[model samples]
Target: MISLKNITKKYGDKTVFHNFNLDIEENEITVILGESGSGKTTLLNMIARLTDFSGEISGAGQVSMVFQRDRLVPHLTVRENILLINENADVKRMLESVGLSKAENLYPKELSAGMARRVAIIRAFSHPAPLLLMDEPLVNLDLSLKFSLLEKIKELQSTTGKTVIMVSHDVKEAAYFSGRIIVLKSGGEVILDKKRVSEKTLTETLLNGQSI
Candidate 1:
């Protein structure tokens, strides 16, 4: 399990989060929803150990992430990029898992935005990380592609049982994809907390974090 206590972050005198506390089940997927500047990305960063903080944090797992921006190696083939992390059989299994088994030889520039995003996701999941974090992973994909990829993501998670934390601007998507939804209001207050509700209810619904 992951434990966060009194987690607070500030830039100079402006506090982004104050005394925030959260616990994430070790193998369960946790989806975080918030508007822009709501500090969702900041929270993900802190969880990934990419940012410093004052609150205590603890976990027993390897972590990897797919950021809002693709961090592909421009000069490397898709396979090579993923192999950079796995360096073994783990790469082949992950590629097949993400539906990218045929695009192994392609370079980043040769692929579309959605394709690149899939490659990044595969790369992150190929490692030994027990926790995976994603930030707006489907932002550039068309609806059909997004739907397809989301399934692929879910399949990978179900297969691996790795903990997932995704930060997304689309609450509907968050509700549909995650088992638990955490809504962070401005100033880091968790105004909404809901547990697995039927996805049909969140199709056009604006969840206020009280459903949980």
Candidate 2:
């Protein structure tokens, strides 16, 4: 499990989280949901140890992250990028799983947006990390691609048993992927924290601006 105690993050004069706390269980998916600029990404960065904050976090193992952007190497082929992280990674298998078998030899510049995102996810999973952090990875994808990628993610998580912490504004995505849902208000206050409920209930909570 991962624990965050008294997490306080600030940017100059503006504060994001003050004495915020959370606990994430191992081998489970936790979704942090909030609107843009609500400090959702900041919270993930803190857990990933990618950002500095005044807090104590424990039980986090090695982490692999997928950002909002694909962030693939423009000069490297899709397989090459995955190999860069894990030399013995099953690049072909991963590509095939995401229906990108033919994209193994293609560079990022030659791949579609959804394809690039798949490569990014595959690269992150290829690493030997026990924890995976995702920052709104499905943001701009079409609905079909979004559901497809979500299935891929579910498969990867179940196969690897990696602990996942994802931040997103999409309630349906949250309902579908998360075992636990944490809704944050602006300035990083957790307005709702509960076990997975129906998508309709989650949507109603968001629309009603209610906290639980």
Q: Give candidate 1's error at residue 212 in angstroms.
A: 8.5
RMSD of each: 2.4, 1.2
TM-score of 2: 0.96
Where does candidate 1 stray beyond 4 Å?
A: 198-212
TM-score of 1: 0.90
lDDT of 2 by residue, 10-92 (tens): 99999999999889989978888888878999988888888999989999867899998888888989989999889999989
Give candidate 1's whole-model lDDT. 0.81
Per-model TM-score on C-alpha atoms? 0.90, 0.96
lDDT per residue as tens, model 1, 188-210: 87766667745554432335433
Best by TM-score: 2
Candidate 2, 163: how far from true, in Å? 0.3
Worst lDDT window (10 residues) for model 2? 203-212
